[model samples]
Target chain A: MSAERQGAASAAPDPRISMRGIVKRFGSVEALRGVDLDLHAGECLGLVGDNAAGKSTLTKILSGAYVPDGGEIRVNGRRVDFRNPADARVHRIEMVYQDLSLCDTIDVAGNLFLGREPMRGAFLDRRAMRDGARAMLDRLEIKIPRLDALVAQLSGGQRQAIAICRAAAFDPEVLIMDEPTSALAVAEVEAVLALINRVKASGVSVVLITHRLQDLFRVCDRIAVMYEGVKVAERRTAETDLQDLVSLIVGEKHVSKAAGAAAGPGGAA
Target chain B: MTAYTSRPAGSRLADMLATHAQLLSIAGFFLIMVVIFSVMSPVFLTTGNLLNVLRQAAPILIVAVAMTFVITTGGIDLSVGSTVALINALAAILIQFGIPWQAVVPALLLIGSAVGAAQGWFIAYQGIQPFIVTLAGLSALRGIALLMTEGFSVPIPGGIGFVQIGRGWFAGVPAPAWIAVVAAVAGFLALTGMRFGRYVTAIGANQEAARRAGIPTRRILLSVYVLTGLASAVAGIVIAARLGSGSSNAAVGLELDVIAAVVLGGTSLMGGRGSILGTILGALTIAVIGNGLILAHVSPFFTQIVAGAIILLAVWLNARVFSRLAAGTRRRT
Candidate 1:
């Protein structure tokens, strides 16, 4: 909450990432069509939409999982093209995939340091890795009793947390998470929202995609609603309640006036 | 807020046990086999007989170590036996032509790598299923071997230093056994303490995820097959050196034994999990059974039956007993 207040007080903070007219196609289906978004430093942007609304696709493009057929991406006012995930990573952009992207049979420490393991000459520095993992988990306030436990043994929320921590630990200027809390329990969801606040406080821009509309109010400074590959509305969290977002996500014409009004009070909290 | 207390201290011990449940079960089975064989046959525990068993089991052990890496990556090299046969025949042909054994040794290894790289190209870069590709290699490679040797055994002349590689002893252990030991130790170190092993495990667990994590997954996949090919070449050379002759018919059906040994060692055929120590025990167990049956005056054919039954039972124990134990402990906590 303090981070959001500070972000608002700043005078027109420069966007850490800017995407203009981003377009992507998947053989005949246009997954993303002419979408524009700007993510400022120290802000969380909540992306919400119904199924097939292009939320995942857009974020994937941003994270370099998909190549945009048309449009430009700017990081810190410099135009850049990401040919692959590695390219985005060079610019300190990280993403927690919807699938989690964790090797189930690998230990928690191993998963966190998957491709870029700490090595001593030709061998993996396992002791250093375990120690680094312990420190990383502690810094995130994530509690898992054993670092060597295989990811398959961990619960869904713990796995999600590990994935998020993996991305966040990279000291990314921008972090994108797709449906991070969709499968989490109530306490886990709260923990994730709190983690987002912490990240924002450190001046990292976060793009969060979720179906849970109410979660945006908890951590997001701004919300962007998408419908069928197009961004329909962008609202400041303090200015617009969840009712506006719900209508915006559903596309205004689809919702009756009664439902919009009915949703108002519940959406405010 | 639930403070997320660490599971009780006892569970730490339980966790360690559960993680190694497959290995421990296999080890127990290996010990039981050793005991049963020792009791049934008086000569089974003799040092000379044991040395012979070690010498004979060396080739299979070496290749099984490589296959552990392959299987851990969710791939199989069915062509390994055929590769061994090809190298076996090729080495004899070269030695018959008066090529020095030292030169031929490295040459055969390179040939093995080339063959593996070719197959790996198809499986890795060409997007073919490893099973289908290696199955094709099994037939083609054996065919090549038969054609080269003309269905005849080629004799390696005596008094050559090449024989020492297979028959000589080092510190009272057979050369081949020493070689197998070296390969196993190297494999253990690489798989347990290296990044390559981690990537292989990751690739097996989830290929796309590994790729997204910036790992060159296809290269790693291709390299594992190369290891198998190289190991097969070593095995082929040892077989030729020991017998002082090479034939295309050598090592026929050997792939099955190697696969069985690896699986019996608790490495999952589905991939993402493996153990070199288990593979070592598994290979020795199979070797012991074959040797023990001959010493016990049992029918040679029954050895196969016993070995097959034991493999099936060990795998069942791993999948059923160990998993259930792990699950039961989880439920209690």
Candidate 2:
């Protein structure tokens, strides 16, 4: 946020979030092997790869939904361990999952403040919640018919907005979006893209995991390519071509065995 | 191109009707029932008969209110009937045991909540299917109730106050009706106004999403079931007081009526939607149907058939209304 912090962020390679030698296994399948990643503050880092590239596994580990067998996660240059998603939230790490977790029976305000609701006296302060929800929606430039409307009645994009609003309201230092735009239409996707831009501008580090290269080019400042389980390459969005990135993901270009062993693209480490 | 756009408007109107068509259809059916009953018996329109219906509906209303919470979270409790029976039997037994009514009542309420929480723990944290877990509880609780009563009725303490709490009229209405109204209001507040209420709805809506959002989901689930159990216990106590006796067989087959009320009230059995007000209406509606049948001199066995039909009709109408509302909203999208 300060100039010195910004200078340190650009000068030193200390990422806002850093994962080194992360390994995760589900049963016999090693989903991720020795994967390493660096995410700088206020940067939109795109994670691009094929379906089995372990993007979700990496996301899960980073979000504290899953613990990796071997890895050190350093947040804001400080080494930390997260036991659960709640712990991750405390460390200013939040995720907007593709499913857009929400309660459809309640109104938008109730959904936005699902876990952490404002309270006055013994009551839930529904009025304050509604007003605060409206403010958050406005801040994110989200348009909905009414704050009191039940989420079940919302369009896909509007539901997505509620999820984004919740994460943003918490003001998490790292926001991971797992294909946030996948379920949306064109206009809705644009709306989400605008929100991403606003989040990035506000200096919250973003990790956008998507197979949509066009989305990566539109919003990501830097792109990280993951081939199989390992992060194979990191390229500035302006410097890297999509073809080169695709090549890196498919392991077409020559890569070090350490990286290859890390990737396990051949299904063996 | 114009027709494509223009036709949607007609379709939109049609969809709106389709979505809410069930509500209209149900309302029509309700009207038809009322007319038929009125024609069949002049006594159906009397205030005394209406009050009698409400008084009889009170216990089911209390249990159904709690059931709405459980069902909204996509769960069910077959144990409520057993729970009510146990409480009824206990209230009378405790009174006979020389336990003061003041302490006896609170103890029963706490015991009810504990039973509910016990069941909830198995469902919420253990990841057990609610139907299986509650069905086990349904049978288990009845066994416990029978054991407590030794398969016999326990006589009340023969106190005027205890009977007054159950059967006495405060202002031309039975005390049970008033207790039910109070409980329903309290249930409504706990669900819609408090943090716990919101969490329950959230869990019902999407448990996985709520978990990701850092909600204490399992705890909330446990608490909802406990609340339901406590409500059923209260219903049981009232039944004991009203009868001046507690029987192991008390509240037998009451689950069907409670569930009927819940479905009629428009709470989705599938999870993630419910209304306390609707459930109350449902309770009253079921009560009215039963009362009308009894007044019309229909066989008691036929009452069960009528209740089943009403429940089926309510659910059908609810689905119809739900689809129409969904279509209405979808058209806008």
Candidate 3:
């Protein structure tokens, strides 16, 4: 895999996107406190934190949903400013919001196309849209029964799948997802995890935020733990176990038993 | 997973029926109304009276077409009747000033767009609720009309081409009826076939989602009100032409009738779902009932009661019966 080749070639690979000293505040409450993050191409970075830990805020800044009060963002080493979500989209950044962002009354194909509908001389090219939507779903191996069904009629998993498909279909350079599997059934979660792997394999950088700690081990190459709006620690998947990550996430000064016993002196690092 | 397989081909008919249950039921109700009216009044079934009904229904039908778009966006344009009255009075005043009807018509339509755009600005940009904004417009606009006309009817001069819009016939149909037909057809095509219609539904379905998806939602919202404004102007012109006069009191309750027609046609006031065909049928049904009642020698006062009752009954059947049928079929499948 290209990702494997890159990992072996350098101790610190070049980042596709880099954020430095990102700061966000709501009135007197600071949501993010000068955070720095780097996402390499073709790698899934897991961002884990408890409630109000600023994980959502950081990702929203990257996705251009929120403007940081102080920050420098560089995409492929070139500095950029994102005034709005549309600006982020121009740089090929797409986000699957926590709410899935699917319109319930719109049909599957309609939701898939959403804001940018295919048109022929001012009229919606519905036939082409349906055909394109089918191809997109098929490419993602999403087993939706009907493309014409209203999104509200779909199961939670199916709706999630549609939302992911819409974001993925745009060929984004960086895809950010917030709590994607939070409300999914076990089987649906498996489907989404598999989908994440498929997206990563296609050479897109992915930033995933999830409370499901176990999920980070499955798809993430690296994990960043946040506490109280600060990036407390970062670890490569090969170097860190779940207990050590959990300790970092919950802000424990002492390492957990499994981690302490397994790594000895390395546990402190 | 196997349970999620494509629906059996044999059930396609059932599926179509279930999906379109609301539209089908409204159509059926409209036909039943026609039969009942035809039986109760001999004149109701005649070509002359039918044309007259269409002529009278023209204003409601035209405005209702635009209202469908507004409602589809989950918004209501309560100021439409006031817009119509203002345009009606304004058109008469212009005609009386010896301005050409040709110049007056287009100018009124532009004024309508300006009025709609102004309200849309408040609703979409200023974050005012559509109901409150349009309600304000409804009051303010009518008051402006009253002020302009000094609470009196402004008479239009006869023997002018302006009167032809209301009085003339085209290809064996009233001109106003023809205008309504064109409006209905355009509404149907725009809603079903055009990108604008898709955005309208999307905005109504979920404004945030639509905005995040890169749709210019606020502009689209603004445009729908503009559409209603333009439509109300056309309706006003037709009314002034038909009566040979314009009054501030004209079409006082027209908004309610237009909204009733749209809702009766199964276009949800909650938005994101609409059918232009249903609106047409709804408008015609209202017209037919009113005309038939008059012909049957029923008091005009009772007409409102019957119309309201029928609307309630039709909507009830739509929500209750059709939903149950759909649910039962889903369980069976």
Top-DockQ candidate index:
1
Model 1 lDDT at residue B22: 73
lDDT of 2 by residue, B1-333 (tens): 100000112344654454344444445555666777888999998888877777898999999988988988888998899999888888888888988898999999999989998999999889999889888988988888899999998899665588777888988889999999998998888777877777777788888877887888888888779978998988998898888999889999998889877777667677776778777777777777888888899999998888787778767755755555545545321
Candidate 1 residues B72-162, lDDT tens each? 9999999999999999999999999999999999999999988989999999999999999999999999999999999999999989999
Looking at candidate 1 chain A, the ten consecutive residues that score lowest on lDDT are A1-10
1 versus 2: better TM-score goes to: 1
lDDT of 3 by residue, A1-269 (tens): 12333431134445788899999999999999999888888889999876899999999899887889998999988899987777888899999999988888788999999877888887888898899999999888887877887887777778888898999998999999998887777777887888888899888889999877778889998888899998888888888887777678766764454444533322221
At residue A21, candidate 2 shows an lDDT of: 89
lDDT of 2 at A137: 78
Q: Estimate, for each residue in B1-333, the C-alpha lDDT of model 3 and write its tens digit.
A: 411223333355676676677788888888898999889888888999999999999999999999999999999999999999999999999999989999999999999999999999999999999999999999999999999999999999888999999999999999999999999999999998888998899888888888878788899999999999999999999999999999999999999999989988989888888889989988988898788888888898998898888888988987788656754564311
Error of 2 at A204 (Å): 1.2
Runs of candidate 2 with Cα error greater than 4 angstroms are A1-14, A253-269, B1-35, B321-333
- Model 2: how far residue B52 lies from native, Å: 2.1
Tens digit of lDDT per residue, candidate 1, span A75-184?
87899999877788888999999999999889999999988899999999989899999988888898988898888888788889899999999799999999898777
Superposing every Cα of model 3 onto the true structure, what RMSD results?
Answer: 4.3
| Residue-level error in angstroms, candidate 3, position A130 | 1.6
**Clash pairs of candidate 1?**
none
Ten contiguous residues with the weakest lDDT in model 2 chain A: A1-10
